[model samples]
Target: MRFSLIMVAGIALAACSPPVPDSGQGVGFGNYEEYQKQQRARDAQLAGSALPPATAVSQETLAADGTVVASNDGSDLAAETQAALGQGQSGSGAATAAGGTGPQPEAVYSSGISQENNFDAVGAQRSIESDAAKIAQNRAQYKVIEAEALPARPGGDGPNIVDYALATTHPMGTQVYRRIGVNLDGKAARNCAKYASPDQAQSAFLSKGGPQRDRMGLDPDGDGYACGWDPGPFRKAVGG
Candidate 1:
């Protein structure tokens, strides 16, 4: 009976006193390091890779029909001029030889530029070629009077000098030379109304202009020229 009473007392003591557990709960992962390398392998791979290739650009050109065209080859002014003049060569379909029954070409007016004309452009170039002294001389005289002034010879007793323009193809490379000269009249027949000759006064009035004539008062409306003189050259040398 005593044993049974003791067992019941122990059971009531155990039920009243609950046991303590471990009491630790999982709060997930702890805080990691503040900074960590993530893409090192990817960065190294990209750094080792080669770069992309460069692109090549081309030049621009034109067609005969006035169209803007682009090309990768070459372009020049001669081609453009030919395109402008509509003188481009025949395409693969057409025959290009003379008398080949192609469309009749238009009559092109070509002038015969004489050897003198050619020499005019070419000679000016050749004359300045090798001699540095000649170049310096030309530089010194460049628009200055290359020759001395000429006047009415010994007694000044002659008709007024006139401009004698000459055209020659028959002379054929004679190297003709010309220059402007004066016709000073030492003997004055009158006061202010003096001239080398009547012809000089007329040509001066016509070419040197009316204002210039007015300055000299040579042509007085049909009154008469050779009435006055400036005692100077008929024309002023420009930039000299």
Candidate 2:
């Protein structure tokens, strides 16, 4: 009975011994696999939540020789874009054609001047004719008034004194003379008119009295006056 108890105790101790190293390695591998699976799931979730990748071309991309390549479905998108672009270009072209293209040069035009001159020769001629007419009229009027003459006076040249006296005294008239009939030793004194009327001559002679009687040697013919004026020639010429 003691021996049987010892064997049972040995068997129990053997069963309680630590596992092998390979067995521990197997357990670690299982834990590592489980951790990798969890990491994969987390990665997938993050990827889904993040923003999408960039598609446009930037300057950096161009420098790197990375051109933008449209997707296979981008052909249809390109066609639509091309149609819109064509429409815009057509509209712009129409507006430009109507508005005229490029900077318009400044407008230039030729300038010309015209001159005209006119003179009224007829008016000048009329003025000259009027002046001639006035001059002729004035000459005619003066000739009519200056036609008469006068008797000569003493102590000056012939007729000139008479003309001057006529022009100054009577202007336009006749002359006559009368004798005083005064007696002298050798000659007789005669009285004559210096004016137009015979009565005027007689009055002048008598008013001064007899010529030699009043003042001797004053009258050459012993007349009352030194000079005698006669109007016979003037009257005969004028026929009045």
| Top-TM-score candidate index | 2
- Report the lDDT tens digits of candidate 1 across residue range 39-150: 5666777889966556644466556798878765665655666775664453522544544775668999978796667967777766645577777878987676577676
Return model 1's CA RMSD, one decimal.
Answer: 33.4
Return the top candidate by lDDT: 2
Cα TM-score per model: 0.14, 0.16
For model 2, how does the per-residue alpha-carbon lDDT over 36-146 read when each residue is reduced to its tens digit? 888899999998999656984332212136665444454555576799799988788677788888446899985543222213545544677798999999988884456
Candidate 2 at residue 178, lDDT? 32
Query: What's model 2's lDDT at 169?
Result: 29
